[model samples]
Target: MKLERKHALVLLAIAAWNVLTYLRFIKALVDTEDRPTGYYVAHTILIVVNLLIAALLGTWGVRAYKASKASQNAQV
Candidate 1:
């Protein structure tokens, strides 16, 4: 499967956005100390999940970009 440059860029952007949004969520969670233990635990789990998703997207984007580049080079 040949990945296009635009698709790779979109994936990278989504990954970056996910990270940024997670940071904001963390900040909000930290700012409130009155939350229950369950609240913290749930948010922590969500944060971990989001981080994993972001990592996956970033990895996919890098791999796609590399694959596209390799294909281009091979075609030359």
Candidate 2:
């Protein structure tokens, strides 16, 4: 399916939000005390997975947006 400008924007927004929010979460996680080893391990894995997802989304969004603009320019 073709990704419209709006879809690209949404994906970019989600990617940005995930990066910003998860960075803050990492700081909080570091500052917290007395967490079990398993807790930190699980959360670290979660953060890694989410960050990977964000990277993928950001890449897709950027490529789609650039393609849309290029197509528009070509039509002119």
Candidate 3:
């Protein structure tokens, strides 16, 4: 299914937002040095959670966009 310009733009914006928001967690995980094992573990968990959320959001957005496009095509 084809996404219109506006739909594509919105998807792009959401993806960008997801990446930007999660980047801090990733940076923390990467940049921290001489930390305790528990500290690393906590950051790892946070990063995993962030990735899961982003994946879920991306999947939902793609499915919704495709469904809308399919419905529009059917009506035409």
Candidate 4:
């Protein structure tokens, strides 16, 4: 498959994981009966922020991979 196709597949997977994981996190936050102390809210927010960072890194990886492949093909 082409680099673009691979990137698209990876992006799709990441999007799916992002949506599903965020839904779970939101559910945990809203379902808590103890009225969500500060720590619990902070932790949930941290988890979300971390996942978003990971997603950004994954996007960078895809871009790097494509650029490298293009350079190699140009040299060939």
Candidate 5:
């Protein structure tokens, strides 16, 4: 269950991406005022979808991290 340093680093990068994407999505939603209704609707849908996907991936990464840590602890 242990992730090599390289693999862990990759997962961490993915987690960071998920976080950044979600944050940017929120910023877009907040800044979408005064735009045309069609533009706002499209952006809102895109943001919501991106947020949902990011959330799912983040949960998976967290579970993997916890499992790896648990394995390391058990070996100690």
Candidate 6:
């Protein structure tokens, strides 16, 4: 589906939220070094995956926003 400017904005907002929330989670995880190696390993994997997702969403949002702007400019 083609994304409008509003949809692109929402995706960017979500991506931003994910990064901010996960950064805090990482800090908390770091403080809790008492956890077992397995626990840390699992959480680390989750963090990595979430960050990757955020990156992907952010990229999509930027591309969509740019495309929409370009189309509008061309039409004007």
Off by over 4 Å in 4: 1-36
Task: Tell me the whole-model lDDT of each prediction, alpha carbons only.
Answer: 0.92, 0.93, 0.73, 0.70, 0.71, 0.93
Q: Model 4: which ten-residue window has the lowest total lDDT?
A: 1-10
Q: List ranges where model 6 is wrong by over 4 Å.
A: none
Report the lDDT tens digits of candidate 6 across residue range 35-66: 78999999999999999999999999999999
Question: In candidate 1, how many Å is residue 71 off?
Answer: 1.3
For 1-76, candidate 3 gives per-residue lDDT tens digits of: 6555467547656766777877876876788799899988887877778677777766666776777778779889
User: What would the TM-scores of all predictions be?
Assistant: 0.90, 0.95, 0.69, 0.53, 0.64, 0.95
For candidate 5, write residues 1-76 as lDDT tens digits. 5564456556667767877977887786787668788887887788778767766766666667777778788889
In candidate 1, what are the lDDT values of residues 7-63, reduced to their tens digit? 788889999999999999999999988878999999999999999999999999998
**lDDT at position 13, candidate 1:** 95
Give the alpha carbon lDDT tens digit for every residue of 4-39 in model 2.
788889999999999999999899999989989999
Q: Which clashing pairs does model 6 show?
A: none
Report the poorest 10 consecutive residues by lDDT, candidate 3.
Answer: 1-10
Candidate 3: the clashing residue pairs are none
Cα displacement (Å) at residue 63, model 4: 0.5
What are the RMSD figures for all models against the true structure?
Answer: 1.1, 0.8, 4.3, 5.1, 3.1, 0.8
Q: For residue 67, what is the lDDT in candidate 5?
A: 75
- The clash tally of candidate 1 reads 0
CA error at residue 73 for candidate 2, angstroms = 0.8
